[model samples]
Target: MKQKKKMTSTGFLLLITIVLFFVMYAAGMVIFADKGFAKPQMFLNLFVSNAGLLVIACGLTIVMITGGIDISVGSVTALVCMVMADLMENKGASAYVAVLAALGIGLLFGIVQGYLVTYMGIQPFIVTLAGMFFGRGLTAIISTDMIAIKNKLFLKWANYRFYMPFGSTNKKGKFIPAYIPPTVVIALIVVLLCAILLKYRKFGRKLYAIGGNKQSALMMGLDVKKTMFKAYVLNGFLAGLGGFLFCLNSCAGFVEQAKGLEMDAISSAVIGGTLLSGGVGTPIGTMFGVLIKGTISSLITAQGSLSSWWVRIVLSALLCFFIVIQSVLASAKKKK
Candidate 1:
């Protein structure tokens, strides 16, 4: 009974977020009926639009659960995109080479940051802040101007769509097909893999133990340093993957690409019930968090009257609300 109660409490915020999404979606259905917000395509659009964000948020969730954070993810993602763009567009590199280079850069960034944080005893925020500057600086050095990706292979992949069996019909009786983007499919696969890593792996259990209490974890013979280091490295790889997905969506890259994207990832993770204090989170919840943000943006777009900034405002409010709830839950757990 105690274990069950603990699990329920841990998941409280996730449940609240799920409820909030449904309520908002139901409201959108009523308010934007004519705009087809009620259509199935709108529902799938959430995944298609925020697929990259979903992957990043899942990465962030892993870090947060281990009592670490990476503020440089946005910059790193932009750098990855810029590197891939520079390689393929300017240097005539093959698509395979560009993709591999982007992933390698991401992994390298993670390894360095992880080393500093785990071995050198640097604060995560300070280390990641430096990382942010380095990544953004490198991106600018590569090219300040936007580079449109004209790589035939990349274009083919980006344009490819997997049509859903069901779709809505327009007033002209033409079938408006619903489709999932490759990026969205990639995000889903990442989420599933993360779910398995967190739930069933030995490293995952150690991560939670360390987050719960570092001293206790050490006392129990856990290799706290190595586990935490590995966590950040994994985060970097996922951030790189997310950058690739973002590039797919845009089919272009620039120094400014994904500016402030780290915040979005962090917000999604928090809203998904990943505790800032660490030791708890789920990738599935993070996916819903991304979906919620996408839904808000969709609702705003469907209305066609509100400024895009409203999405930020609403998300900020939601983020704050979830944070407060987390604080209260943490306090209660302590009292217990």
Candidate 2:
């Protein structure tokens, strides 16, 4: 056999990073430079603002890589947080215990969806679309209002910030200034682990293979169903994890949290060059994609000149454009 072509991933990642950096840089200059973005807490908001998006995008990337989509992830996230709040308040469960229970619920959904798609020969789109509805309704059943989390452990974790020693000088010739949150640290760790898995592991490789061509992968004896099943489970788990973090950050949970977030995750994946039809993508690209999308919102919000809804308009156009480009590229590669 010809030496298996190892996917050269960094080029795509670098491109996304460069594009995202410029977007952020431009936004910062236009919106934040007046005070050098020098608000005491503004620096820290950079990480906090995009933390949940990063986590959501990371999970979504894995599912996409397997040629499957988890449109329900956003809803699952909302439901997971609802579970946490209900368990803590109604059942008097500890926050830690509630979190695990939430994760379990996510895993349960994963199993159901995975089974339907893999064993029943159901289409991913159909299975996950139904899952999306199920998760949404479940979230509504739990609560339609914002459920405030007052658990002691949850509050303590939410309030903690991991600060770096550095800053601006004060008028008195003393230093004044910044901090980072534990959320950023947690987000980074999750992103890093995902990158490593997507880039290095055997399962990761198998994910690409199954996504690239299910028939060919099966001919080579790869357990296609099993792989996709694992990917979905992981996606659900991450959704749950992300939901928990989002709750920790916002200190509340509601049915509508992360609304339309599946699109956000998919858009990030595509911009980062993860093929829509499947088989190619990276966590790094998804990360940059999240940053870029986040920057757009920041740009619009900071200007105070337009409704943030414009962000969606731009994202929709970009998504269409990228999908077309991807289709053309996949065809060309096939002919070659």
Candidate 3:
């Protein structure tokens, strides 16, 4: 008789997160009933508000699965937004051109960091740290001030919304429609593509092999350097995409844009079931992780009396708890 394999730690963590989200959401609805946290719009708003973070978290999940990290993604996102804003607002460039330029910069930045990490034998942390500083410095050099985006095409896209079939009535006796932003749609597409790439592609398989054990992957004749390098490139591209979505949400850019956003992405990825030790994760799980953060923030907002910093405090605590769980899981795997 064939025995069924035990559920993996990643699977277990993902299940926990899924349950946690529903539990937290239910708790919020019970506590903030008067504030209408139970509305469908409130739920839809989670995706609409966190579309950018979704993309960023997906990118971070990919890199983490390859047993590497990119602390510079948030800075890269800021740089992308700043560059796009400057090009459109100051240089009189077309929105299309500005967006392409931002994507190109992100790709270039990723390639350089990847090259240093994979070819030059530099540590991922040190290289990404340098990349982070460089990105932030370039952003400031462009302009320390916030630059509002006034491009007609960009504005049109930002304002475009797709309303859901169902809606809720506000306390004012008016029908409030639920809709998702174009950015949310874009983020969803990216997530789907990433999910496919990671689950069904040869490159994705190699990444898992490498992350599971570099020596074994090398023995199996995988192109470790090339795969790792391409992983960073993909991460960079996604970061750029995330920056564009974030700009759509904010309609402005500044040097401080997306500050500490890397932490958010990382924490989200971790919470989503991506192991820091690598070789275990899913994009779908990361999406849920992003939603969890959005839900927390929404709950805090509904409370009204809570400090905004409460979100950060709660997130940090959750991050710590997840990391501890990962550590325990790793230890168990080693023992087995």
2 or 3, greater by lDDT: 3
The TM-scores of all predictions, comma-separated, are 0.96, 0.89, 0.96
Give lDDT tens digits, candidate 3, residues 243-326: 889888988889988888888888899999998888888899999999899988999998889998898889889989999998
**lDDT, residue 13, candidate 1:** 82
What are the runs in model 1 whose C-alpha is more than 4 Å off? 1-7
Q: What is the C-alpha RMSD of each candidate to the true structure, in Å?
A: 2.0, 3.8, 2.4
Local distance difference test, candidate 1: 0.89
Candidate 2 at residue 64, lDDT? 89
What 10-residue stretch in candidate 2 is worst by lDDT?
1-10
Kindly give the stretch of ten consecutive residues in candidate 1 with the minimal lDDT sum.
Answer: 1-10
- Residue clash pairs of candidate 1: none
**Against the unseen true structure, what C-alpha lDDT does each candidate score?**
0.89, 0.78, 0.90
lDDT of 1 by residue, 1-336 (tens): 232364666677888889988999999999889988888988998988788889989988999998999999999989998999999999999999989988898899889999999999999999999999999999999999999999999999898999999999989999988999899899999999999999999998998988888899999999999999999999999889998998898888898888888888888999988888888899988888898899889988988889988988888998898899888777776676
User: For residue 39, what is the lDDT in candidate 3?
Assistant: 87
List the candidates ranked by lDDT, beginning with the highest.
Answer: 3, 1, 2
